[model samples]
Target: MAVLAQDGGLAFYGEPDEAREWFRADRIEDIYLRLAEAEEHEWAGRFGAAPAPAPGPAIGAFRQWVLLTRRSLDLLTRNRLTLAVLLGSPLMVLAMFAVLFRPGAFSPESPSPAATVMILFWIAFGGFFFGLTYGLLQICNELPVLRRERLTGLRITPYVLAKATVLLPLLAVVDALMLGVLRALDRLPAMGWGTYGELFVTLLLCSLAALALGLLVSAAVTDPAQATMALPMLCFPQVLFVGAILPVPVMAAPGRWLSCAMSNRWAFEGLGHSLGVERLWATGRSPLGPPLLDSYGDTFSRAPVVDWAMLGGFTALFLVGACLVLTRRT
Candidate 1:
């Protein structure tokens, strides 16, 4: 009997038991290099002549997640440039903020209202940038490998989740450091740990949402260059519509509604509310403070949870969107 594999591998067996033993051996020595192509169907025969032993039970999603997370961490840590950017970018931005925004802006006596808002807006934007940059290349660069693994019963859920699991903690740390460093430098106001905690949560969520957005784009694109090309497009709307440059209420009707959709908008407002920016602008000695707050009416009016919920919803939506994109890509 002759067995021909998909890759044109040919094997001759004298009897049924001998053919079964060859299939069980799981070894197909291709007389030629092409013959070495080991496919189960060739050994099984086109009409299912011989059946190969089944693989062990499939791996669980949790196990896959763990393994994937380990591999991802290994890759991230080994890439010194990536590790430096992840940890160093925030500090670099913080220094620029410290130099760019004058001290005592958050001070009660003659505070700089514009400076205050800039500090908050830039801080929020920084977190988003970190998350987005970290995630943008993650999937696209490894897509070939991912596509190959999908045939091995890899679940999209675990794959997407492993990306998140590996990166979110780093984001959390970077965000916390942003707050702590700004406070230490007096770029941000001295506040209770609780207030700092609220700010931290807001920034972390902001990063999470951006990370999800990055992952979605990464999965949709074909290569690293394409992913890089998307950075400006993704970031432009985030900065423009975040309500920092133009307070949402003061924006035109179309701009007003669109601002509601920006994850950075929620994050900025959340940080504002947590820091009591409304009250600061209301009573600060800066002559411009009240006018600015009036123009931003009701933006920081809602509770922080409302903003939190919005950010959380965006993260969930983007992550699920990434999973869907991956499935389609395959």
Candidate 2:
């Protein structure tokens, strides 16, 4: 903590008191600068001789986990307002869809097709509105923190895994709330045990796809503002390819591939299939659309359960692509 000074060509200061005498000589700046250099040298003397960084296996593991956990938690917690907006918007949209298909507004004999269209609308609402919002928010919100963590040696995969873990339960709650609201309005189709099970699986897939896609976008964008603005750019196109508005066959070849890339179309078709409205896919049309009246005629019937296999496939593909991008490219 004390410095020895050179004066008269000799090391002069001999005691702490002697050094203090010079320090109180009205030369505060010079004394402080010298003192700082001395302290830095003293610190170097203590550890600079060591050959290697200290081994920290347990500490390293704990540090890595904490970093990932903290970042993931920060992402969720920081976006409370956005989350509320995203979550609330879906319910409101679903409510609007239900209002459009209120009981007795359509003939009783034609409920299935109408209900089917409404349900697909709800699913797509989940896909476009909630999905894009959640995805964009996750990516945009986490990017800066993620950059900082990467600088400190945190793996993006574990970070993403932690994010997915945190999101699933929250998304489940959102899904449940949406389902309850739709059911309350008698907007949901009645499906049996197997069908409901398939539907649950499909919903989770769609949610995962949304979250993962968001992560991918987040990784690619430098500006949070840009990420936020980009959601509609990514989501609206999904509507055209949803097979409900325009049949898949009517879409050009590129449009067909684009639809294949869209998780929304997959989710809608999967949901329709789960409801036993097999006619939706019989010709690559969302069973929820026009000819909808012909298929159900009036009341709801359990459509054949969705193809769980295909739902699983698309879910895996989206998630895998997300993970790859998040961990490596992003």
Best by lDDT: 1
Evaluated at residue 160, the lDDT of candidate 2 is 62
Cα lDDT of model 2 by residue, 55-158, tens digit: 34443545565766776667567978966775677668767766676652222345455455556646645744565566665655666666676655666656
Model 2, C-alpha of 219: deviation from truth (Å): 0.7
lDDT of 1 by residue, 1-330 (tens): 555565443454356556556555433443223335555555435435545446678999999999999999999999999899789878888888878877788888778888878888999999899999989989998889998999889999899999999999999988888888888888888889888888998899999999999999999999999999999998999899999988888788998788888899999999989988888888888889888889889888777888899999999999999999999987
> Which parts of model 1 have CA positions greater than 4 angstroms off?
1-50
Error of 2 at 55 (Å): 4.2
Q: What is the Cα-based lDDT of residue 278 in candidate 2? A: 46
Instruction: Please give the CA lDDT of all the candidate structures.
Output: 0.86, 0.59
Q: Give the Cα error of residue 287 in candidate 2, in Å.
A: 15
Candidate 2: segments with Cα more than 4 A from true spot: 1-55, 58-67, 74-83, 104-108, 112-115, 278-308, 318-330
Per-candidate TM equals: 0.88, 0.69
